[model samples]
Target chain A: MIGVLLLTIRELRAKKIILGLFGVATLVWVVLALALRLDVIEGSLAGARLFGEEMSGDSDLTDELGEPALGNSLLETFVFGAEMFAAGAAYWVGILLALFATGGLIASMLQQGQVDLLLTKPLSRSKILAGRLLGVSVVMLALLTYLLGAVWLVMSIKTGIWNPRFLLAISVVFVMFMVLYSLISLTSVWTGSTPLSLILTFGLLFASLILAIKPLHEQITQPGRSIVVGLYNILPKFVDVGAHIVPQLVVGETVESWFPFVSSLAFGVVAYALAFRLFQRKDF
Target chain B: MPASAISVKGLSKTYNSAFGKQEVHALRPLDLTVNEGEIFGLLGPNGAGKTTLVKLLLGIVHPTEGSGELFGISIRSPEARKAVGFLPENHRFPEFLTGRETLDLYARMSGTTDMDRANKSEELLERVRLTGSAHRRVKTYSKGMMQRLGIAQALMSNPKLVFLDEPTDGVDPVGRREIRDLLLELKAEGVTLFLNSHLLSEIERVCTRVAILKEGRLVREGTVEELTTQDRIWRLRSTPIPDQSLGDHAHLVSDAQSNGLSEYRLHAADRTALNASLDHLRLAGVEIESVEPLRQSLEELFIDVVEDAST
Candidate 1:
């Protein structure tokens, strides 16, 4: 097992494309966050002018509506700014990172015949697959760490506030990203070609997201809403987890809840086992 | 119990193709044994089931019929593989790894752990003359270097039995000679080598015993001398027309033909009969010039066997 892990690390280290892709992903997230923050700043400043006029004791003197609307304070403005940036950036970042990492990790191994070399080892097939999953997971974590740090730096500069909840939110999103990517990595083993694997993984991810959204539409005007919700809950609804984290971050809430983490982790584990079994039975 | 390193009996394989069910009959219920510490060569042309046989012994492919044992363990058993090393024909390793790392990975896979791994990699790289390019990725290595590295990986565990499938393919003459010397050294160290190659000359130079496969069946087996000795024919060149045209004795078979210099060529079964014919010719007043044995070359032998099997 250790041998497989060591070899996996060695192989991943030798691949420059994986590192380059992760760098591209981090840059994309940072740019998206800055753009979203700029939009939030513009909206908040517009609302602040109305609130300042309403708070001045001159309601009747104002031709504007009664007691101008409550404007966002500096603290509220910054908090809202951070929330907007995190909300827009977190989920997309997770999906792109998951897709890129998962598709490249297994596909590269299969493409380069590294899998054949690994199987020739005395290690059991299961151990080799597991080690590879873990190796990719480690790389995903590193990439997530770098992205999270970048997000924090950008958020602090744009919002002028260092809310620890922003970090917690990024951490939760990163965990969710890891689960999604690990599942995709497991699925990529099914299709031997890189592009095919990537397409299949992304297709499944998109299909699951669509299924998860079906419940919301059904709840507004239709029966069988409970069934739709139940079906959505059973799917690996990463989008729902992202939605949950967004609200939690906006409310500055702690995320020690066991349900979301356990559920995602369980799904990730089962997906990995299934993928490993399939790969083991496959002939190279 | 003469310490046979490899023993196979009744091995067979069949494949189902779109055209029809193609049954190869690779081994055809054949029995073979290689004694320990001998350089045994399995020589044949392409599609002769050599690679299939090697794959079966390595447990990479399952045999449809029959069984074999290596080092007294069933071929299917992993324990047998532990004592065996294999260099598959035209196999590609991960190009991302350096030559040294490739050896290290294979060594680790073979269960050479901790202290031994580093030392073994260093020793093998140096032995294969890749020590200078140890840190260079395998993609940059020439075909000869890759073949050498393949051998080095196969020898990483110092396995008792090494199977090399065309180990010298794509190798330069110098590299080929070096590999031949390496095989000899390994044999000197009491390692049993199962070499499968089409280069009959290489086998003639090194193999003590050989098995030639023709169309997935063992057509010939024995030492080089043993196979070549069958149906021996001698060529005799003589001067004047021999009055004894080799027709008197049934065993003294000869095909006599005259050349421009008053020379006659005679083909006979053996020297004694040829001597008898010569004596008869002398008594009959025919002058004799020279005599020689017509030996069958390995190419002729291989072609004859393969052609005969096909028909």
Candidate 2:
């Protein structure tokens, strides 16, 4: 299992896409740091500028009102807005790109020659599969941490509004990606075709989006409504998760509900269990 | 008593296609044993259960019936492979990894210590004459180089048994000889070798015992000499035989050469009769140049076996 982990780490490093994600993360921080020029008058946000223009909050920051008119709440609100955008982008785009990058790995590992070499080692089938998934998860978690961690630092330092709850979005995004990964793994095992696996995974992904629409749930007639709602309960709640979880965690608002997150997690667990069983019983 | 390296009893496999329709019996019940310090070879046509047997032993595929053991450990247990190494026929190492990295990774997975992996990998690289290309990625290596590197990987664990499938398939003559010598050295160290190859001549040269499989059944198994010997017949190269002494025992197989030697196919009812004919020729003053038992080559025997089974 450790050997499989090393091999996967080397493979991902050679591919260089992870390096691009890190670079994107750094760029986000650099742009945030430069764009928000803050004037600290006696340890208060006396003035703030957005790309060389006066930043306007609910009221105003620097003009017409009085001395040091900008309240810390306005600053917190501004930082919260920036952090939410970063969280949403990292959750949506980052997870999508990560799935694209790793979707083929399980299928490739199951190819005839490679699987023969791996299974012949003194490791059990379960350990080998666990090792492969661990490798992917470790790399993805690191990338997400770097991106979200940098963004959080930049926003907090510039506005002096540090909401540690924002860090929870990192796990939120990471777990969501893993939840989706279980589906890809099952697809890869069932059909050893990488393209077919990715297509099916993406197909379920789009279906989840359609299912997340509340209007679709209401408009459907009785029998069809039961089927669509059942489907919604079964699939990963991708769009609902985007709206409820990461954004709420970023803005320091009360999460709408934990049912969506827990149910999606249950979906992931079942998918992973099915994938492992099939992989263990498969004949190269 | 010598320890048994491998023991199989009534082991079998049947592959079910998608939807569980159209089942193919890849292996019938097989009962065999391979002793330590012997080079055992498996011979067969395509789809003859050779690869299936190897995979079953390695636990890459589950057996449908019966069981096997490696060095007293059940093949069904992953620990049975702790001291086993395998070089597959068409192995593919990740192209991104250099030869050295490939060895270290696989050796680590085989549960070798870091120190052992380092020393054995370096040592086997030099042994296979790939020390110079150790740092080069596998994709850049030639087919012959890949084969040599594979042999090195198989040896990194210092295994008690090694299964080599087509070990010399793509090697040039010199490289083939090197692999042959390496295999001999492993055998000298008391490593049990199970070889599966289409190269009957190589198998003939190296294997102490060979088994021929046809249609998922073991059709033939024996030592090379035992399998190929022609019964009650001998080839004699000698000086001119007196026609009277030749009697009905010898048939002329070649015309007399300038050196005055000719070959004859000598028939005998038994060893006593064979010696009697030779003694008769000696009395007639015909000098014996050489005499030996006649036998078929392994290739000829393999073809006959496969064709006979088909019939």
Candidate 3:
């Protein structure tokens, strides 16, 4: 398995598309770093504004009312807003990109001529499956770390507020992806078709998000509610899990309660275990 | 005293199509044994269960009935493959990896020790005549170069038994001869080889024993000498034939005249009687120029076996 993992890592290193994703990520960070600027003001608390683009020569930092305004620190507000975008918009896009990038890994491995070389080795089917999973996971983890760390660095340099908790978002997004990728891996093993695996996993992802809504949960009958709740519990709570990251950073939310984390971890474990079983029994 | 390298009994395989709409019996119940330190060849027509049988022994496909063993270990277990090396037909490696990296990957996968891995990698690269191209990516290699690299990696572990399917399929004449020499060298080191190829002449040149299959059944199994020998025809060449005194054992032929020399085709019941006739001719002053056994080529034997099975 370790040998497989090492070789898998080598394979990922040569994938031009994955490197292009990393470049896009860095480009996004660079644009964000240059476009947004925030600073401290001694006179009016109302001067708290995140300036986007150039405001020109003589515009007052304060509003026309000339009264002290909403918040004290402009930097905290800016960091808070950026965290939301990172967690919501950027994270979801990253998930979609990952699905597109790694969707064919298992399917490609199972190709007629390719699978024969791998299966003829001295390793068990389960180990080979696990190693491939880990290889993709490590690549994703490296990408997330780079993007999150860049965001942290840019925010700290501009705002002088280095929030250590901001880094947790990397792991949060990675875990969310792991939970989703497990479903993709299982689908790949079951069908050996990349498009089918992608469609099924993405379909279940939207269904899980819709089921988590409180109003929608209320609209269903008692039996339907039970089924919805059961599925929500079993599937990784992607929206909820990603939504919780920003509050913890900007608002000092406690990590004491772990619902989606534990449940999602369990869901990923079960999916991979089932995938391993299927891969072991498969003739290819 | 050599031990059995592979032992199979009643091994079989049957594949079912989606929804059970169709069924294909890829292999029937078959029995086979391959001894250590010998090259065993498997010859078959298309869809004759040759690849299926190799996959079953390698545990790539599960057997539907019966069992097999490799080096006294159960074929169903992964450990049974620990000392085995295989070069699959139409095999593919990761295109991004270089020749050296590909060999390193297989060596590591085979769990070779650190010292032996380094030494063996270099040795194999030289043996396969790819030492100069070891650093080039496989995507840049020609088909013949890729086949050479494939063989190099298959021998990386210095395994006790190696299975090669169409190993020289795309190699040129010179490259094919080099591969044959390499196989013979490995045989000298007591490594067993299981070869499957369509090139009957190549098999005849290197294989110690061969098995021919047709429609999932073993049609013929024997040494090259046993299968191709035409025992009744003893070809004898002499200076001239003044052959009346040689008794009824000699059949003089007018068509045997060539370049003022007499070439006689003698028919005998068996090799012992053939040798007796040759001795009698020697004392009678009919100078013998050459004595040789006339036999069919491996191609002819293979065609005969497969066509006979079809009928």
Candidate 4:
């Protein structure tokens, strides 16, 4: 097992495409977080001033006022800004990062015949597949760590009060990314081609998200509410994790929902095991 | 002496294809044995089942019928594989790894744990003359370099027997000579080499014994001298002697004049009769310049075997 792991690490180091993609992913996450922080600052200051004026019962704070008063403390504004950024950008970043990293890792190995080389070794087929999965998982974790640290640093400079719950949200987001990456890795092996694997992974994610939204949309006087609800039950509700985490962090609400986490982990493990078995049976 | 390095009895293989399931009896129930410390050559033309035999020995492809043993272990058993090293024809390796790394990986996989795999890798690289470029990626290496690396990897585990399929297929003249020398060195070290190649000159030069296959059947098998001796041919050159004055039993095979010299090849039943005929010609005042037996070249022998089998 260690031999397979060392060999996998060596192969990954030799591949420039994976390294370049990871670098680009890190840069994009940092930039998005920074931009989101700015928007949150602007939006929060405007919202707080509107609320304070209404509470003060000032006649001059009329309904016709185009601009609301700026908030008093920069720290309060920054925390509000960071929370807003997490709600809007976290899911998209997680999904894309998972897809790109997992897809690129599998494709690069296949294209270079690395898997063939590793299998020719004395190591078992399962160990080789597991080593690759482990490597990709580590890379995802590292990138998530970097992104979380960057976001917290930017937000900390703007806001005095540091929220540990924001860090916890990032950790949950990393776990979600890992589940998605495992699915993509398995699909890449199953499909045996890069473009096709990426397409299937993205297609499944999109389908799941769309299905999760149908129940809410159908309740607004739409027909086929039962069918939408059935789909909502069948498809994975990945967005619920983010929705649940963000609200608990911002509103101080402790909600319990471990089903999605357990289900995603279970699916990921089974997919990985199946992919490894198929790969072992394949001639090349 | 107790056990043959390799033993194959009645080994045969058939392929099922889309064109009406054409069956090719590759081995044709052949029997073969190679003793320890001998260089055995499997000489044949294209589609002669040499590669099939090697694949069977390596357990890459299953045999349709018959069985063999390597180093006293059954061919089907995985334990038997530990004693065999194979350099497949047109074999491919991962292009991402360096030459040194390639050898190290194979050595480790072959169950050489906690040992000096790196040292073995370096030694083998130097043996194949790829030491200087050991760190360069395989993709950047030339064809000859790749072949050298392939040979190095095959020898990494120090197996009891090595199966090399066209080991010098794309090598240059110098590289071919070097590889031939290496095979001889390995043979001297008591390692059995199962060499499969169409290059009869190589087989003739290094093989202690050889077997020829045609269309998946063993057409001929013996020492180089034995195979060459099966067919008789002799070339004679002498001064002009009138055909009417020639002694009895002097049938001319070919008579030609080159640079004012006459050359004639004669067909005789035996060496004594040939000598008698040569003496009679000399006594008849036909000055003899050179009289020598023209043994069959390996190429000629190979062509004759394959062509005869086809017919």
Reference-based TM-score of each model? 0.73, 0.94, 0.86, 0.69
Residue pairs in collision within model 2: none
**Would candidate 1 be rated incorrect, acceptable, medium or high by CAPRI criteria?**
incorrect
Task: In model 4, state the lDDT of residue B278.
Answer: 78
DockQ (0 to 1) for model 4? 0.15
- Report DockQ per prediction, comma-separated: 0.23, 0.73, 0.61, 0.15
Which CAPRI quality tier does the interface of model 4 achieve?
A: incorrect
Question: B86-168 in candidate 3: lDDT tens per residue?
Answer: 99888888999999989988788878877888899899998898899999999999999988988888888778999999999
Better of 1 and 4 by DockQ: 1
Candidate 1 stretches greater than 4 Å from native: A21-91, A101-104, A107-116, A149-191, A215-235, A245-271, B17-31, B232-295
Local distance difference test scores for all models:
0.69, 0.89, 0.82, 0.69
Worst 10 residues of 4 chain B by lDDT: B247-256
Query: DockQ ranking from best to worst?
Result: 2, 3, 1, 4
Which candidate, 1 or 2, would have the higher DockQ against the true structure? 2
Model 1 clashing residue pairs (backbone): A51-A71
Estimate the overall C-alpha local distance difference test score of candidate 1: 0.69
| A210-257 per-residue lDDT for model 2 (tens digits) | 998899999999999999999998888988888877877676666778
TM-score of 3: 0.86
Residue A46, model 2, lDDT: 69
Clashing pairs in 4: A122-B109
Candidate 4 local lDDT, A103-135, one digit each (tens): 766655554234434443444556667767777
Query: If both were scored by DockQ, which would come out higher, candidate 3 or candidate 4?
Result: 3
In model 2, the Cα lDDT at residue B229 comes to: 85
